[model samples]
Target: MKKSIVIFGSTGNLTYKKLLPAIDNLIRQKRLKKDDRVYLLARHDISLKQYIEDAKKQVKEMLDWTVLEEVLEFVYFHLNQIEDYQKLNHRLKDSGYTDNVFYLALPPKLFPEVAKGISASGLVTKGDASKRIVFEKPFGENLESARTINRELWRYFDESQIYRIDHYLGKEMIQNILVVRFANRIFGQTWNHNTIRNIVIIAKETEGVMSRGNYYDKIGALKDMLQSHLLQMAALIGMTRPKTFQSEDIKDAKVKVLNDLKLDSSSVVFGQYNGYLDENKIADDSQTETFIFAKAHFMNDKWRGTPIYFITGKKLDEKRSEIIINFKDDTNLNQIFSNAKPNNTKLVFKVAPEDGVKFQLNVKQPGLSDEIISGHLDYCHTCNWVGNTTEAYEKLLFDVLNNNKTLFTRWDEIEVMWEIISEIQHMNIPLHVYDDFDHLKEIILTEKGVDIDAL
Candidate 1:
């Protein structure tokens, strides 16, 4: 039987920009059975038809033109009071279908409240098929907040029913981390145990936080990106071989890394930007951070001594996101070392702005000279290759509809991700303000705990 999906935060970016378009595509491809029902929950009062019209228009504007729907027949929109228990129960029961999924695309603050309200209204128990809720990044400010949010969500749904959305897992490149490591014979052979020198995962954004000043302040680079995106990438790269590729096995390995993380790292560093403060409409006293750099060490037998460098920030030079794997360079004994050329084979996973992977090896530069040189051969992700691969929202929404919890993070992972980040945040490493041009040099010159230069 087709499940009924009710998307919370229907007017939010996830819904308008991603989920609605995905559903439109799914419907166009006949993936969403005619029997399925999609409902949009928002605070504003709008008719079902109006909501569909708005969605179709937004899809056309923000995304591809092919996604525009002439008429959205399956979607319904309604104003949500949330506190009105009886009204919510009655309205949901009106669906006459039990296979239900509730997607919470709203802000993190609203996650627990929405869940509790739904529970109070008995919408969770009323579902005959399944009861699930999905949410996005920064599950909480810290471990304490994460636990609290979990508690709030549990009141409405069990751990099994809650789906915490981590887009990093859904990214083509982030997921490829596993495929590249395990599938390739050459890399896998030397992936660990004295063959690798270091792993640097950098997430750089060209633009500053446009309108999310308040949101960005409370959750800076560490909690916003590192605790979620970068760490997930690191976990995949640093984890011991899993027994299987099963979702449980994959997640189990990820959870172990976070749990086993060491807090006492003189290697870690954090930072905040200065110029962007003028962009924020909020007060000057706002302590929201925009830049963060830190090194996490895994003292395991295989990965021991291999540095895991993490760099992420806003209002930066380039809009590139990648993982640079610097292999052990031992050409110093040769003339190549005298030429100041390092044999660093970087396995770059380009995440945003472009999604693809390329291995930069020391290949023959070609042409006249026999001198060794380096270049890259990229395996570009053509537009058509993923023409139908659903957006993050669509995949997640489908998971919610199918009652799948594989993509969701376990509370244990949440607690641990926060545990590691909380210690770094508590230390309050001195911040170094810098301009975009000389930022790199400035960081390199800073003292330990006080230096951005260490990066």
Candidate 2:
């Protein structure tokens, strides 16, 4: 997160729905200083009063009245008109600003322009206390576009100054995979090829595009989710120890996670959902894929040959997200009490609709019978229990204020992400057909206790 936040595309859906609200919540929790300035940078041509009222209404709807005053005070907007940007500059100077963060929350096409313009303004000095940039998803349409965004960011800022916001990594449980693994000696010792078998990271949403049909077509599931969000989760699950707690160090390990991936057609599966091509808003001839599932590998000593399965889609089944790790096959597999096993265990980190971690372990049934079974040692995070469980947006904004980059993404991560996903798209691997996707969809729906046909 960049300090003294300047958010581009502040008038967009993400800012109104996620960013500003999170900031308001954090302020209510007293997690931020009153002095931190959050400047909205958009071409909306709105007044300070107009933006303030819009943001205030957003805060009111997203939070209680307790959060409104401080939130409204800190949030100021820059219209980004030539004169407005200049006028905003004077306002910053008179206000005695120390740090600045430029958040590019717009579409991919606007990235280079915004970066170039911001740099030309001379506001992004390398010697500042903390100058960062926050950008949303679809960093690029593909490998070339990904490189383009990286190049643009490079022109204006160094690797450290760019904080790519992959909101998935900011989720509490997703972040805790490392914590659960490394903190507990028992789990950490067993987290390797010797014990773990298959790891599946699936981000599924039931509705197709909702209203972003055209945008969805341009960048399908492969680019939208797997390239950034799902892969980030895979990196967290498979990475070895890092040297430091810094974003650079952690991202250094993530790059290896990508380099280790099997970047070819074989030993992988890629699928696309096209059921909506003939539906209400989408084009009848469009080949836009709403669903994607792929198998990947890390050719490293620890996780060599371990299958990393990834699935993401917009309109599929229910709206659910999770990471499941399955251990290797067992011999003398008991059929009577099939759920039970000697060494098999599973750990699931739930990221959305709620935040929590649940693990599966085998044990004898709580009866006189000599049968074993599987059960969960569950830690579920219910929002009802919280005074301050910051949303991903709030946490990112706070990181910007505090100049913390640990929770944000780095460029190398983006590069590696594009390289891996682009391989699958370019090669046109022997993909699983519609039926296979439906089968997987059924499996996913089974998890939610819903029959696919019923919907």
Candidate 3:
């Protein structure tokens, strides 16, 4: 059966740069069937031929002309209007594709209206289970808005027919969180709070909000990163072992962690960059945070007393995303020295700029007195082999096409995350304003007494 994909905001940044390229790459790699129909729907006035050419250029000069032409032949476009939802039903039927997947790339606020329109327009057949919808995140501004959107979606589609996308969940390393924890007994045995001291997840970017200031000002770092991406990672880290690697089982484990999460108000810190107000379209009085640092804890027996630090910032020192697990130091190190310094072992999942793992171990200094120092055992995924790694969108799009919900976010997960974030928003935590990366690090060191430079 052919799948018809309708991208709602076809001309948006996400569609052009990420979605189109991902689809093209998937077709090129033969991960996607060449004949599956794709409908590009947006308000743009461009012709279908013109849009196809434009999308081709954005996909770069890949040498898969056979598959590319086949994909292009199945492509169509429509100028979206209020009534286009009704027209879409006819369009899909006329194209002989009873099954359709709608990808909403528009602003989060437009979700409710669009969902209602699709439902009212009879886009979904009464007996057809093949209709699916994919939603991009910042699912809602807060808990209430999220619930409202979920309610509207529920009116039209079953939970199984809706796919909530979080690109981070599609990353190869992020997916490997399961394998890293369950497949390796060394790490799995010590995964509890009994051996693990603290876990820190950091997503630091060197670039600031350039043209996205409007969206950034409204969503900020809490809703943008901490509320969604970091929380998802925490769930994977803290959850108990799933019975199977299936999507529902993985999600069940993740939901367990989300349900058990307990936020420490004193452990939360929000910050905004100094010149954030100077960004284009940003208001001078905007109090939105571009940086966030919080300590999240799971209330279960496996993770009690373990603080999961969630940190993210834009316009920082460098671009990096990492999960650092600091294990408890050996208490019997006094045998080496009466006052031996504690060097706790760290297991790091370096997610970006490099996709790899690093184990920081304390070893005796070579050729000297019995002194110890930290050493790194690193594994670089892209160091030697292969062409480019699969983009997050590519993996996510593949999952959607194949009806594999393993990498997609569940509504229950999103609801609980927003609930946690809404509580933090009302907690009255002050947003620390800083000039640059160094200043931000200084503040973190002073307030939290944790060394940012070391991590």
Candidate 4:
């Protein structure tokens, strides 16, 4: 069976930085066989030779030269005017391919237009023949908008044919959260709120939105990071173990977990960097939030009373995405050591800048006296196997090619996510202005008791 990938907005940032490089990697790894064809669809008229030259300039440093050469041979350029589906269908049919995957790497506003064009053109694969469409998030600004988009997409594509990608789901450590919770006996035993006191999820960047102020100012950190990525991570870590690793089973658990999230006025915190107003294209009076710190709790018995803190922002002190699981400190040792109670065992899953796992434990120091000190059992994926860990886009793209939606977001999940966001938006929370990441941390700790000190 021959498959063709038609990528709209092929010259955009995502296509240049991630999509093409991932395709090149797939070819090098022999996952994307040579028989498959890649069509770069755009609104403008660009020669295939010129397009290839531009692509080469962007990805040459990251991709091997030979891999790029072989991958380029399978690539084709098309002047795709998605409004006319008949010509689009004719163009695809002429390419001599049946199975199709339409990847829209364009702005959210263009999704409906392209989808309608695909549907009206009737240029897709027939029943039971593999045809899929991939979309990136801001699934919609709010719940109502998300529902509308889902409805529009459903008109043309079946639920099975739609792929809503959340790249964070493809992170090595994010994928490992399930294994750590369900596969390991020790972690599995203490997975519930009874043993675990709380969980902290953090995604931070040191650089501000200097170049992307126009986009960042509109969406802010709440919608850009917390609503999709942080929420997804919290659901994965907090959800009950699925019946199996199958896509449906895992997705079912995630949806249920999200449905159990309780949001209130008191639990939400929003912030904007001090200089965010001064950024180009940003309004001085804009109330957009570049930082968010919220405490969310699960309504289910398995996670009752356990607070899951969500924190993320641009222009922070550090650049990292990690999950910190703090277990309840042991009281049994309080009688023996008097002042030295058993330390809280923390499980850390580092998701960015590197992939790794760290277990914080209390151990007796090497001395005549009984001095307890913190010890660590850590495994750094990048350190041990440098340049071997798969990029999030690489894993995600391969999953789309293989028609595996396990790491992808579903429509139902997106709807629930937007509902949660809408509730917070209606609360009219103030966006606190912070001078730096440390000041933001101080405010969080002082007000919410969320100690974001380095783990």
Q: Which sequence of candidate numbers ranks them by lDDT, best first?
A: 3, 4, 1, 2
What candidate 1 gets wrong by more than 4 Å, as runs, is: 49-85, 126-129, 263-269, 331-340, 383-386, 448-455
Tens digit of lDDT per residue, candidate 4, span 6-109?
A: 78888777888888887877777877777777777765566677777777776644666454554343233333454455765776678666677888888787
Cα-lDDT of candidate 1: 0.70
Stretches off by above 4 angstroms in model 2 are 1-3, 33-35, 48-60, 64-83, 263-275, 278-284, 329-344, 382-386, 428-455
Best by lDDT: 3
How much is the lDDT of residue 76 in candidate 4? 35
Quick one: ranking by TM-score, best first?
Answer: 4, 3, 1, 2
Residues 30-60, candidate 3: write the lDDT tens digits: 7767668767776666766677677766555
lDDT against the true structure, per candidate, is 0.70, 0.70, 0.81, 0.80
TM-score per prediction, in order, is 0.87, 0.85, 0.92, 0.92
**How much is 305 displaced in model 1, in angstroms?**
0.8
Tell me how far the alpha carbon of residue 252 in candidate 2 is from the true structure, in angstroms, after superposition.
Answer: 1.6
Per-candidate clashes come to 5, 0, 0, 0
Output the worst ten-in-a-row residue range by lDDT, candidate 2. Answer: 446-455
- For candidate 2, lDDT tens digit of each residue in 1-455? 21356677777777778877776667667665566566766555666667767766654454553434443323344434345556656666677775767778888787877677666666665545466677788787877878877887787787767777888777777777778777788876778888787787878887767656767767777778887888888888888877875677887887887788874445444445556665556777666666765667789889876777777776556678988887764666665556567555677888877678888877778879877777888887764575656667777777866778888877777777888766677765443335444775554455334332321
- Is candidate 1 or 4 superior in TM-score? 4
